[model samples]
Target: MKAARFHAARDIRVEDVPAPGAPGPTQVLVKNQFCGICGTDLHEYLGGPIFIPTAPHSYTGGQVPQILGHEYSGVVEAVGSQVTSVKPGDRVSIQPMVSPRDDYYGRRGQYQLSEQLAIIGLSHPWGGMAEYSLVEDYNAIPMPDDLSTEHAALIEPTAVTVYATHRGGVKPGDSVLVAGAGPIGQLQVMAARAAGATRIFLVDLNDNRLEMAHRLVEGLITLNPGSTDVLREVRARTAGGVGVDVAFECVGAEAPLGLCLEAVRRQGVVVQVGMQGKPPALDGFTLTYKDVDLRGSWCYSTLMWPQVAALIASGQLPAEKVVTRHIALDDVVEQGFEALLDKAGTQLKILIEL
Candidate 1:
C-alpha cells in the first residue's frame, strides 16, 4: 500500500508501506477513497510534533512517522466479527477521535473532551491517506445512498461548523456575522443559515474569499475590513444598528476576535470556532459593559456526525459547492497542501483521491 507519512516538520514522504492487518473483533478495515487535508495537518507539517507524538501517545500508543489525514471517507473492505452496524462494501465516513472508554469524559458521553483524546491519523498506526486503514466500528459512520463518496468526506469538517453554529444558539430569523472566509468560514455561513438565521454577514480582508462566500451562500452580505468599516457596515445593514444576534470568529487571529465582539448586538452570543496559535488579550470592559455571552467552541461531539450527514443528504448543506480542487494522493504535498499555503487565495477544500 502507498501512504504519506510524516517524519518531521517539513518532512512528509509518500512511499510504499505494508497494508494494515485485518480488523480486530470491534474494528473495520476500510479502503480509502477521498481524504481532505486539514489545517491541523498543515500546523504539524510546518512546525509540529504538536499532535503527532514524539513519544508514544497515551491512547493510540503510536508515534511519528505518522500518517497525516483525518477528514476522509471510504468503502468498507472488511469488518470484524462483532461489527454488525455496517458490512463490507458499505460507504462510510471516518470519525478520527479516539479516547479510552473508562475516561470520565467518555463515560459521560463527552469523549471529545476526554483528557487522553488522540486522533487516528496523528496518533494511530492507520489513516485515510493510505490505501487502506482500520478504525473502531463505532467510528465508521454509514453514508446515505444519495451522497457520493467525495461528499461524504466532508462530514467531519461539516460537523465542526454545525456544532459551532449550534453553540451560538442560532435561531430562526436571527441575524449573524461570521468572521473570515476560509473553508470553515464558508461552511459557517451555511450552518448558520440552516439553523434558521435570516440575515448573514461575513468579514474578510480578501475580496476573493468574500466573493466566494457570497457566491456559495445566498443572501450573505460580505465586507472586507481592509477597505471599509466592517462594524459600521454590519450595523447599517442590520436592523436598528443593534448589530447581529450572533457573531462567529472563524479566523484564528487577534483582529477577527475583536471584530466579532464589535459586530454582535448587546446580550448576543459570540462563538469562537477557529483555533488561535497564541492567546489574544480580551477587552474586559467591553464584554462587561455589553453583558455579551462570549464562549469557546472546540471539536464536535461524536453524535454530530450523523446529523451533519443527514443535513448534507437533505441538501441543506451543499458541501461540494466549496470544493475548488481535487488531486491524486501522489500529488497531495505539491497540489494540495502547498496550493492551500499559497497566498494567491484561489483554493478551498482540496480533496486527495486515493
Candidate 2:
C-alpha cells in the first residue's frame, strides 16, 4: 500500500505503507480511487497541528506522522459482518466524523458538534490519502454506479455546502450573495442557486475567481468588490438597499464575512460557511437593529450525505464543474496544495487520482 503521510507542517509524502486487512465487526475496508485536497488540508500543511484530540501529540495529536485526506471515494474491498449498509465491491464515499454513542449531542442529530468527534484525516490510523482506508460502516455511503470517482470524491465537500445552505434557510425567489469566490465560495454560489435562490451574487477581489464563478454559475452575477463597492452593485442590480435576502460568508476572512454581516437585508439570514483563522469582529448593535440571523455552520449532518450524493448523481449540482485539476497521489504536494497557494485564473477542486 502507498500512503500520503503528513509528518509536520509543509511536509507530506507518498510512501509505501501496510495494507489494511478485512473489516472488523463494525468496520469496512476500502481501496481508495480518488481523494481531494481541501482548504483544511492546506491549513494543516501550512499553519497547523491544531485539532487532533490526543495528548501524546503535544504539538499535534497526530498531524505529523498522520495520514491526511478526508474528501475521497473508493470501493469496498471487504465489510465486517455487522456492516449492513454496504458490501464487497460497493463504491462508497465516507462521512468523516466520529462520535461517542453515549453523547447527548450525537443523539440529538448534531453529531457534527459532538464533543468526542475526531476527523478521519486528523485522528485515524488511515484516511483517504492512501491505497486503503478502514472506516466504520456508518461512515460509508454507497455511490451510484453512474457517478465518476472524481465526482464521488467531491460528495464530502458538497455535503458541507448542502448542510450550510439548508441551515441558512435559503429559499426560491430570494436574492442571495456569496461573499467570496474560492472553491467553497463558488460551491456556495451553486448550492444557493440549487436551493431556489433566484438572484445570486458572487463577490470577490480576484477577477479571475469571479470570472470562474461566473462560468460555473449560468445566470448568477459576479461582483468585483475591488473595482466597485460590492454592496452598491448588488443593490443596484436588486433595486434597493433592502439588499440580498441571504448571504453566505465563504472566504473565512473578516472582509468578506463582515460584508456578509452588512449586506443582508433586515431579517435576512447570514451563514458562515468557511473556517475563520481569527474571530471576526462584529457590532453587537447591528444584530439588535437589523433583527437578522447570523449563524456559523460547521460540517454536515450524517443524514445529509444521501442528498448530497443524489445531487451529484443527478447532475443537478454539476459537482464535476468544480474540479479544476486532477493529479496522481504522488503530486499532491505541489500540484494540489502548493498550486492552490499560487493559483488563479482557472482552479477550483483539485482531486488526487489514486
What are the per-residue Cα lDDT tens digits for candidate 2 across 206-290? 8878777766667888888768888787777774668888899888888887788788888989898988898988867876798
Global lDDT for candidate 2? 0.82
The pairs that clash in candidate 2 are none
Show where candidate 2 strays beyond 4 Å: 53-63, 343-345
Q: Which candidate leads the pack in TM-score?
A: 1
Q: What's the TM-score of every candidate structure?
A: 0.98, 0.95
> Who wins the lDDT comparison?
1
Give candidate 1 misplaced runs (Cα > 4 Å): none
By summed lDDT, which 10 consecutive residues of candidate 1 come out lowest? 208-217
Tens-place lDDT per residue, model 1, 174-263, is: 999999888988998999988999889988888877777777667889888899988888889888999999999998888899888878
